[model samples]
Every structure is written in C-alpha cells, then in structure tokens.
Target: MAQTTDLDLVHVIKRFGSHTAVNDVSFSVAPGEFFSILGPSGCGKTTLMRMIAGFEDPTSGDIRIRGKSMIGVPANKRPVNMVFQSLALFPMMSVGENVAYGLTSRGVSRAEAEERAGRMLERVGLKGFGNRRVTALSGGQRQRVAIARCLVLEPTLVLLDEPLGALDLKLREHMKIELKQLQATFNTTFAYITHDQSEALVMSDRIAVMNQGRFEQVGSPRELYHHPATPFVASFVGETNKWQGEAAGAAPDGTVAIRLPSGTMVKGQGRVADRATLAFVRPEAIALAQDSSSLGGLPNRFEGRVSAVLFDGANSSLLIDAAGFDEPVRAVLPQAGPLAGIQVGAPIHVGWTVEAMKVFAA
Candidate 1:
C-alpha cells in the first residue's frame, strides 16, 4: 500500500503589496519524508516557507499539517520548529543553555530542561561541548547546536531555511548526510529550502522545483533528473544539452520526433505534445560506443563530432557538435577507457535512449 502524504499545501498563495510571491501553489509531503522546495532567488520559495512556518500569513488558500488548517495560528503554536541559516543560537549562553532555551520558556524546571538539553546536545554529536559558549563553537558545530535546540522539543516537523548556507563546500556536503541521518533518527518530517539543486537532490525524498511563484515540477531526484517536466526543470536540476527542433512527428507507440536544424530527425518516445515541443537530454545519458554508431530507426540516435574534450579524473566531458544542432553538445564518458582516445576534432558518435530524454512543450 502507498503511504499517506503529510504536510499538504492546497492552492497556497502569498502576495505582498503589488506582488504575488507564491502563486496558487500546491503539493503534499509524505510523513517523515525529507522534502525540499528549490528555486532561484525571488522565485517565492522562502516566502512559501515563511507561510508554512507561520511567519507570514497566506494571502489566500489552505495550509494543512496532518489534515488540520494552520491559517491564523502563530509560529510558536504550530507543531513545527525551524532552524535558520543564521544559526540563531544565543552567543553569550553555553551550548547547554541554548539547547534548553525552548524547554525553559515552556515552564520546564531548570534541572530537567538542562538534562534534556544535554541529551539532545549528545544526540547532535555535541555531548561534552555543552559548557562551551555558542561563539566558541565552529560553524558546523553551531549549526548542530541550533538544530539540537529546536529538535529538543521534538516537533513533528522541522523546517530548515538554508541551514547549511554558511558552511564551506566540503562541510555543506558533509552536513547533507548528517542532516538526513538526524531526520531518520528522529523520524521527523523536514521541510527544507534551498536554491542549490545538488543539495536538494542529495537530501530530499521528493523535491518541488519552484519557478516564479509556482512549482515547475515535483518528483524524486531520479525522476527529476531522468524525466523533467519542463525545460526550466531540466536546466535547473542538472547539466543538460539542448537541441532546437520542431515536432517532426511522434511514433504510434508514443515516441515523439523533433527535426533538427541539420534536417536530421532525432526521435525520442516521451512527449504528450500540446504545442511545438522541445527535446531535453542529459549529457551523461549519451554513450560512447566501441562498436559502429548506428541504431537502425532506434529512438534518440544521433551523429556528432567531438568539438572539445575536457578530462576530469573520474569522468571526461566531450563537447560534440552533433548534426542538426548548431551549438556543441556535451557528453560525459569514462576517463580511462575506450573513451580516453576521443580528442577534439575527432569524429565521435554519441547517442541517448528514448527513455533518457524528456520533452516539454512550454
């Protein structure tokens, strides 16, 4: 049986003076699932998050948690906790004190709150560091302390507003796994916000990719990567190479065709067309074949030349100038195998399967 989804946002909309920030958006998150809202700046991700966190009231529509409405409720009363990018830990207080702040305010006795705080600190990998001031802790540690503080209350859901934004690349990457682990450990529903696609892909069970106040697409990391719903999603989620083509035709079996500029027709079977559609492809989907490059009437078969070859240790990227495409197409191949001999100006045959291509009309 399918698991019931939690955290429903039904037609949620938020508007500021003379501007609509979140426009009639809707999606649900499953219970205990790590979900992320991803988009560029000014795309309304943060504004939507604020509404969910009860910081900003929605101009219209329903915001539900476990099926109850959260329309007029304030942030403090919501069954959710949020950790901000700022790490908002009280600098003057010890780590223990910071973690106990919520409990102490809620009428818990000092000794009891402090003891619970200590346990939470340990849970976040800060056991013996409780006495240290927040200012003395490193960026990552401060982040953990801030999370420990909010999570000590054991909110059913935790909202993270770019909590790893201040960390370095390596630490940001490290914290992604740590955050996932913490979520699993606590079995908490986490609503995360980020502009970083990699971060969303790494952490989320499902992702809602926002664009200009609406969700452009929502799916698992693999779904979004392998089958983007729109051109915006294909470009935003990862590296993609585009080829402009008009809808030549579609196969009776459901594969679609796009006639490229070079008068060659590349067919891929994944479009339910409503208008002039565009073919979306991933660079890594293109294969470098050892045998002859010909798939008779196969979907997504194309011929191109290696315009450039840039080698990374683990993988190499080949910029191929495919027939029917004006710009160079990028293809990823193994660094130290049959693809190693591929050089700039060398004739190379690259192709992707129909399943690897995503088509979008708009």
Candidate 2:
C-alpha cells in the first residue's frame, strides 16, 4: 500500500485583494521529514506557512494533512501546531503551566496534563524545570520549552515560522542542531519557513526555494548547491560571486562562454546562448596562488591584487581585484596553507575550471 504524505499542497494560491501572496505553489512532505521553505523576506514564505497553519485560506487549490482536506478547518481544529518567532509563551505562567495549557484547555484533567507535560519536559532535556518560571530560562531553554509544548500534542505536522529568529547567533547555531534532533526524536513532520539560507541548508532534509510568491526550485541541499535549476536558486541558496555578461555561444566541449563588459571571456556550463547572461562562481572553487604557474594552464586565470582579507578562522577569504572583472573576486584561504597569511595589496593569481561555473540567462 502507498503511504500517505504527512502534508501536501496542490497548486495552492493565496491573494489579498490585488496582491497574490502565494502563486501556484505545490509540494509534499513525507512522514517524519524535515522540510523547509526557503526565501527572502516578503517572498511569501510566511504567507504560505500561515495558510498551512489555518490562519489564512488559499484562494485556490487544496491543503491536505495526513490524507484529509484542511479547507475551512479552523486553526484550533487542525491536526497541526505552529511555533512562531516570538514563541508567545504566557509570561505569567510557569514552564509547566505553559506546556500544559493546550491540554487543560481541551479538558485533559489537571493530573493527566501535568503528567504528560512533565514527561515532555524531560524529553526536551528540561527535567525538573516544569515548576520554574518561563522568564527564568535562557534563550535556548525557552526555545526547547516552546517546542516541547507543541510536540506534546502529538500533532500530525508542526509548522515553525522562523522560530530561531529571536535568538543570538551562538544560541541560534546551537538550537539548529537541537531542533533537528528533537524533530527526529519525535519523528513528526516539520514544515519550517526561513529567510536564512544557512538555517535551511543545515537542518532541512529537502528544501523548496521560493521567490516572488513562486517556487524557484525544490531539491536536496547537494543537488541545489551543485545543480541549480534557476538563477534565483543559485544566488539565493549560497554565497556566490555573480557577474553580468553576454553569452558567447558554446565551445566544442559543450561549455558555454560568457563575454563580460570588460571584454574578458569566461567559459562555463549552461544552455543560454547569444543573449544577456549571468555567471556564478563560488569562492571556494577559485584557486589562489602567488603566480599563475601554480594553476597549471587553467583556461580562466587572472592576475590581481588582494583588495581585502576577510578572516573568519576556517572560513577566511581574500577579495581580489582581478583584471577584467568589474567587482572583486573572492577566493577561499585555507587556515594551514602557504597563502593563509597572505596580506592585502599582494599580487595574486586566481583560476578555476569551466566545471566550477554556473551560467544562466539574465
């Protein structure tokens, strides 16, 4: 027998007066999968999440949870729960009370609710924390409390809308792994929406990259990073240096060339020909050397001076003002390599293979 999906949206469209918030969006999340909708702010990711949470209704199409239509079903009646950015925990309530609120409201009985809430608190690494005030916990602790509150309901799907947006950088990083672990522990479907690409890349089983109220691409992290289907997906999913140019047709080896405004020619793999095009090259893909000899006759080699050095430990990089490119090209700096200590204003050679580039029509 075919297994039913945990959540599914079919050709869903949502509009507010003249503006279409979500346009013909469709996708499905398998049982226990951690799926994320990734996009920039106002790209309609939040609107889509709201629709799934029953806060907003789609103008067209259907939303299904565990094989049943959710049309006209109120938020409270749906077999789903949402954890918002603010968490919205009651300030006056104790941690236990906040977690047991939904159960008590449903008449689960005070003793049963407390027992369930206590077990859930321990499951989230907060044993003996139920009697503590919600205001006394740290940011990460509060985040887990919020998640535990929702997970205790054992809903079919859990919708998270930028739940970590309020945390500091260090805590947010810690919480990402924790959230993934918690989701796995429960094996419940998670439909997360986030504007931060790093969050989606780190935590999602599959990501749907949305833009301008439509899905740009949907694939695994590796597939999206190595084989982007659209320009928006390429630029939005990761850090890439973008260059505008004109397509110079394909080479005999099936690689397409792009002619930059500086009259420099570069080759990459793409189908765009004889039109305005954009080329993308990742910082780590470019090989940097003191001289071109180290690059061994690479097809795309440029001599330039280091315009700046950005240091982030293992993620350090150098900005090169390469010849023939309008903006500086960034190259990764290995922490233990010979070029690791290279300084600004140093002459450098940067090169890459045609395989490292991605070209698309503008």
Can you write out model 2's per-residue Cα lDDT over 1-362, one digit (the tens) per residue?
76669998999999999999899999999999999999999999999999999999999999999888999999999999999999999989999999999999888999999999999999999999999999999999999999999998989999999999999999999999999999999998999999998899999999999999999999998889888999999899888899999987887676888899999999888888558998999999998888889998778999999999999888888899999999999888868768888999999999999988998989
Model 2 reaches what TM-score against the true structure?
0.98
Error of 1 at 54 (Å): 1.2
Model 1 lDDT on a 0 to 1 scale: 0.84
Assess the local accuracy of residue 308 in candidate 1 as a C-alpha lDDT between 0 and 100: 81
Tell me the tens digit of each residue's lDDT in model 1 across 1-362: 64476689999888889899999999988889999999999999999989999999999999998888999999999988999998888878998999999999999999999999999989989999989988888888888898899899988779999999989998998999998898888888999999999899999999999999999999999998887877898889988887667777777777777777677777665665664666777888777664444544345555777888787765668888777677888888666666687767777767777767676674
Identify the candidate with maximal lDDT: 2
User: What ranges in model 1 sit over 4 Å off?
Assistant: 1-6, 272-275, 290-303
**Candidate that scores best on TM-score:** 2
Badly placed stretches (over 4 Å) of model 2 are none
